[model samples]
Target: MLVSIELVPRSKEDLLRDITIVENILPQINVLNVPDLLRFDLRSYEAASFAYSEKKDFNVIPHIRAIDIAPDAPLPCVDRPEIKEVLVVAGDPPPTEQHEVYPNTSVDIIKRYQKEAPHLRVYAVFDPYRRSPKEELEELERKKEAGASGFFTQPIFDTNLLQLSMDWLRDETVFWGISPVLGEKSRRYWERVNNIVFPKEYDFSLEGNIHFAQRMLQLVKQQNDNAYLMPLRVDLGAYLTELQSFIVY
Candidate 1:
């Protein structure tokens, strides 16, 4: 299994610091959900430089937000030779802005990135439960047609939901399942932090969190031995460590 970490920095300095810490521990990690439309100014450049400096072979796959994909426009700066892969997401617009003002979809970005960076691999995000199985399959097909190399799902809590998605998409392309590690407090904290409204009946507990992750991993492995597991959230270190232990055994 290839273990990677998602870098969600609130600022350029924090991003650099996170990369520095990651470098000291692991050789490389995938930088997740980086906005492509942001200015490649001094601070952003410095953050990228520091990340690359830590591990020359580190794959700095920026999360290419869907909105940055302008129809027929030039590829973003992250498509440069230095970056080798990108995770394309239907990014949420900035809190202050409306998505209607955005120009492109995740597919458009994938198509442009594939053209500009022939060596770069494009990973698209899919949410199965959010839509019908047919619609999900159609979206996956659309992404593949637009040049997506792989698929990644949202933070999954139910195994059946994942199985349905995999059954529909198994023959189409490879996919990575998102297993988030958010303890009770952390989950509640993030819910508020992201302005996401949680169910009033939601129970936040460590046992619940671990059960969710373990079941998801089991289902993914059962469905396909080759399926890649991509756990989300910052506290996934424990889950990764446990996964490593299983591999060792």
Candidate 2:
């Protein structure tokens, strides 16, 4: 199985520090994905530079939201030889709605990339958390025809997700996302930001939350070979230890 970690954008200095920390654990990870947030956040390209600078062997996938680019114009980052894969989405609008909104959806972006930048691998985002599996497959099939070859999912806490992955997505590249909330503060953050009230079975105390995440991973490792960790702003030290121990060496 391949483990991919999400690297959130931050100040250049902090980002550089994170690169050092990630390098120590890079041998254990297959890919580092850089995320682009709603606000005028640090660009993923800057983070990509740090990954490329390291004289190491690993994959770096930077996200580029459709809201940020024009389809006809040149995409500087897409032209780079080092970045072979990109996750394209119709990014969230700014909280203040201040920025100029680009009128491109991810489908439009995918169609454009398929024709203009045929060399780059475009991945679509999928969220099967609250929805039906059949509907997710229907949508993914459309994306596949449009040019998306792979997908990254929203946080998952159920085994039914694994069932969908194993049954419908067996041939396609899938990265199952898991986030372990450190405590109530972190849990509340998820609730407020994503409005996700964890099902009672998956929500209890912090330990229960970690248990739920572990069970999700154990289920995933059995059926799939790719997983993405998306613990937003939660410290990863203990979580990494748990993952290293759980993974079969």
Q: Which candidate is the best by lDDT?
A: 2
Per-residue C-alpha lDDT of model 1 across residues 31-60, encoded as one tens digit per residue: 433434343333323344455665466656
Instruction: Give residue 131's error in model 2 in angstroms.
Output: 4.3
TM-score leader: 2
How high is the CA lDDT of each candidate model? 0.57, 0.72
Q: TM-scores across all candidates?
A: 0.70, 0.86
Residue runs of model 1 more than 4 Å from their true location after superposition: 11-50, 69-73, 77-79, 98-101, 172-175, 179-203, 223-249
Q: Candidate 2: which stretches are off by over 4 Å?
A: 38-41, 182-197
